[model samples]
Target chain A: MLTVKHLAKSYNGTKKSLTDVSFSVSPGEVTVIIGPSGAGKTTILRSINQLIRDDDGEILFDDVDMRQLNRRQLRDARSHIGMIFQNYNLIEPLTALENVLHGCLGTKSNLAGMFSLYRNSEKTEALQLLQKVGLGDFAYQQCRNLSGGQKQRVGIARALMQHPKIILCDEPIASLDPKSTTVVMDLLRDLATNDGISVLINLHQVDIARTYADHVIGINNGQVVFDDRTAALTDTAVTDIYRKTTSSERSLVYEG
Target chain B: MIKPENQVSLPTQLPAGPRFTIPLRFRDRRRVTMLITLLILGYVTLITLPTMIPDHFKLVEAITGFTENIKIMFLQPHLSNTSWLSLLGGLGQSILLAFLTTLIGSVLAFFLALASTRRFAPTALVLGIQSFMAVIRAIPTVLWVLIYSVVFGLGANAAVIGITFHSVAYLTKVYADSMDELSPEAIETLQAMGLKRPAIICQALIPYLKPSYLSWTFIRFEINFADAVAIGAAAGAGGIGYQLFMSSSFYFDFHEVGVMVYLILAFAVVLEIISYRLRSSNTAQH
Candidate 1:
């Protein structure tokens, strides 16, 4: 389980990108954050891994504060927290299996890592993970040669290689076509439902979020407006969560 | 039917052309034409200025003499003083010098390039290394060789050290530039997965940089070979270049010089073929 409390960030110290954002993700559940562009969905996900250090926050993963950890501790903490990107982010020149094996880099010795001395066990696991994601045949193929859907699947296998407790996906399907989006979303959903891994996703497609998410967190202008079960996210609630915020409404929120 | 207020009404007889044209800001057609014309004029003036021959110079006789020398050199090239085996040995020495320098320089440059990249090192360190390298690169490789010749006393040692030093600076700049072209997202993904800097470099940077590194190092190797030949006579390094220098300047053996020139050209052609083979094979693997 993970809990983020009072997370705030500002680029220029003037305009807040995220304001008092608070949310929690449960184990074995697909939690999707939905918002329009620049609504701070990405900021929140990046902040969870401490990738973009936030101005103020308490990110408690199993009651350990992620923000308070030192360099070594943060790396150790991050080893258990997998992240996926919209771009797939696999080293294109490396083979698919190699990219998957890279998932365990946090657990390897520096010398071993430099020489890429993956053990037989680790290599087997990587190949298996690729197989699980339906990329067993393309294990030795370069990632650049993979299609978008296949690449995202490879990325998923990579995250799984970490044996992570939770996976944070930042618009993983943004660049994907409709069919690839379905395949990737189904894969993430399967990870949550069957594998019991926590899945936290930032999504722009409301319909996809509604289909896959067990819980939904709706953000508007850096503020969390809706946080509840998917069944509770009625049409009206969805509309209200996505409604444009005016200056007066912003001022009202600021006052409150 | 009423048109929407947001929609503008069009004239029944529309204008045939645009009324106001957007002018070119900095490089209009006329300005480009004028600039090119000025460059041509400058080039013509430079060439014509060099044609101010001395009043009594026998231009025809000099041309004929030059042609005669060329004919003898090309048509009757044969080693008179230097044996073929010695020339081959000299070429081999020069090649070994180049190979040694390139290997040493590329290894040193790899580490320095990592430090110079902003992703791996601190901003101050990156900037410092980059600026220092720029200073090193500003001076030509030959000058560096001569400068080291002062310290090492003008021999193969000086040539090797000097060439390697300049090669390091040159390769570092290029390697760092190639490293900079890697997508930050790829690095961030690795970092987010808890990979350390070294692991990220090995797993991410190295694979991406392999092709570029190979090509750049090979290019530097070629340059080092050429520099080795030049410094053989200049720094007393003793290679084929020294033999050519002796034959042409001291003995006035144009045929021997021609033999050396052809040997160098053949070697250069072989190097080019090897480079092409390497580049194509590397691309094919990828």
Candidate 2:
């Protein structure tokens, strides 16, 4: 389980990007955060992994405060937490299987990592993960050759190789086609239901979020406007979340 | 006029056009001034050219003398002091010197680049190393060889050290720039995966930068070859360049010099072909 409390952030001491944001994600469930563009949805997801350090906040994951950990401890903590990006941030020059093997880089020694000395079991496991993501044939293909959907699937396999307790996805399907969107979403849903891993996603598509998310958190102007079960997010609630800022309200600074 | 079914109604009143305080004609005055200054400089240089020549210099006679030398050099090319086999050996020595310098330089540059790139090191360290490299790069490679010769006493050792020093600085800047071109997203992904710095560099950075590194190192090799040839004569480091120097100056053999020039040209063309192949293969992979 992941719990964020009183999350506050300001870039370069300018206007606030996130204001006292707090939320909890339960295991065995898909929690989707829906917001308008520049609503700090990316900020919230990145904060959980401490990718961009939050100014003031308590990010507690499995009773360990993520913010308080030292460099080494933070790395150890991060190894169990998987992250997926909209761009499918696999090393484009590497083969799919080689990229998947990189998931265990944090666990390897410096010398072993430098030499790329992966054991037979690790290679087999990476191949199996690729198969699981329906990319068994593309395991040896360079990621730059893969289509957008295939690349995202490769990313999913890479995250799974971490054996993550919670997977944080920031707009994973934003660049994907409709067919690929359904495929990626269904895979994330399966990971939650079958694997019992907590999946937290930031999305712009309300209908898709409604379809896959067990719990929905609606954000407006960096604050959580609605946090409830998916069934409780009515049409009006989504409208409130995505409402455009008026000319006067627009003067209030916001960073995308 | 009937509206298209899908077309929306246009706005009744469009906003005003963007306003500027300065007049349009005066806005580009700075450019006009720069052009005028360049024209004046050109006129001055053209007027002063003849006056700058020495009193003893005779243009027609000098041209005739130069053509005579060129005619003898190209039309009657032959080895005088050194045999053909020895010339080949000298060429081999220069090639080896260039290859050895490039190898050592690239290896050292790779590590220094890792430290100089912004994503890896602190701001202070990055700035320090970059500025230091800038100073090293500012000095000419031949000048560096001369400087090192003062200590190493003008031999292959001094030439190697000087050439390698310059190569490292040059490669470091190019390598770092190539490293900078890497997608920040990839680095973030690796860091988020809890991969330490060394692992990140080895697993992700190295593989991504491999093609670029190869191309840049080959470019440096070409440069080092030219530098080695130059320093061979300048620093008393024996190579085909020294042979060319000895034949042309001491023995006054223009034919031997012409032969050496042709040999160098052949080798240069071969290097260019190899470099082209490397570039095409790299792009194909991409």
Candidate 3:
């Protein structure tokens, strides 16, 4: 379980990227955040992982405040929180197996990690995760040679390698085709249900969000405008969240 | 039916204009600029022609003599003064000097490059190391060799030191550039996975940089080989270059010069083949 309260951030001293954002993700639940572009959906996910520090917030993971931890403690805490990106972000030159095994770097000794001396047990687990993600045959294949869907599978296996309690996904399927999108979304859902891992995903596609998410949070203009269960979300409410503003409407009227 | 409001009266007489007018002089700027440039070049050549060639007949005679000498040198090569074994031995020494210098220099450069990369080191340290390498690269390789020769007394050791010094500087710049171009996404992902700085660099950065490192090292080796040949003559380092210098300057044997030139060309071609094979093999593995 994870909780974020009163999270606020501003790139400059004036304009806010996220204003008073708060949310919680329960275990084994998929919480999807949907918004138009530049609506601060990614800012919330990045803030939770401490990739981008918030000027005001308390991100409590199992009752420990991430903001209060020092550098070493922060690193230790981050091992329990996994993250996936839109780009797959797999090391291109490394094989899928090695990339998965890289998840163990945080736990291994500095010298051992530098030499890539993964224990047999860790190697076994990494291979099993690869197999679970349907990349067992491509374990030795370099990531650069993999297709987009296959690469995202490797990314999933790599995240699972951390044995994380919570996983943050930032537009994991944004670059994928419709077919690959379904596969990745289905995989994420299955992992959350079977492994009991909490997932906080930032998505732009409202239809996919409504289908997969148990809870949906809609954001607009750096504010959470809608938060409810998927069943309770109306088509009208979704439309309003993504509607173009009135200033543009007025300009159109003037041109006409 | 035609609309009454839209209808207009037509002009009876055609507009008076010249049948054939001169074309616009400055319609296209590029053509005009080129013509002006050609005019200036021709004027300059005409002004300088008399000064450049005061005696055309004497110049023609000198060129003819030079051609005759070249024909004699290549058609009839003399290999009597130096034995084949000594010439081969000198060639081997030059290659060894290049190899040793490149080996030591690349090792030093790898570490210095790691330190100089912005991803690994802080701004102040990276700037400092980069500035130092720039200074080293600014000086010519032969000048560095001459300086070392004065210190160590002319020999192969001086040549090796000089080439290594310049090689380290050259390789550092190239290696640092490749490292700088490394994608930040992989590094960010690793950091998110809780990897420490060193682990991230070793796991993510170094493996990505391996191919570029090898290619850069090979290129630097080629440069160092050329430097070795120059230093061999300048510093009195015993190599094929020294033999070539002696044949041309001391013995005045153009035929021996021809043999030395061919030997050097053969070695250079062999090195090119080796470098090409290595780079291709590396790419295939990746």
* Winner by TM-score between candidate 2 and candidate 1: 2
C-alpha displacement of A199 in model 1, angstroms? Answer: 0.5
Task: Show model 2 residue runs off by greater than 4 Å.
Answer: A245-256, B1-60
Off by over 4 Å in 3: A245-256, B1-61, B278-286
Fnat per model, in the order given?
0.75, 0.75, 0.69
Ten contiguous residues with the weakest lDDT in model 3 chain A: A247-256
Model 1 CA deviation exceeding 4 Å by range: A251-256, B1-56, B281-286
Error of 3 at A21 (Å): 0.7
Write model 3 residue lDDT over B13-93, tens digit each, in one string: 877898777886747889889999999999999999878876655977889989887976777776968999999998888
Error of 2 at B117 (Å): 1.3
C-alpha DockQ for predicted model 2: 0.57
Of the two candidates 1 and 3, the one with more favorable lDDT, higher being better, is: 1
TM-score of every model versus the real structure:
0.90, 0.91, 0.86
TM-score of 1: 0.90
* Per-residue lDDT of model 1, residues B195-268, tens digit only: 88888888888888899899999999999999999988788888887787899999999998889999999999
Q: State the lDDT of candidate 2 residue by residue for B1-286, as single tens digits.
A: 6569968889998789867576666548789899999999999999999899999999899999999999888887888788999999999999999999999999999999999998888989889999999999999999999999999998899999999999999999999999889878888899999998888888889889999999999999999999999999999888988898898888898989989988998999999999999999999998
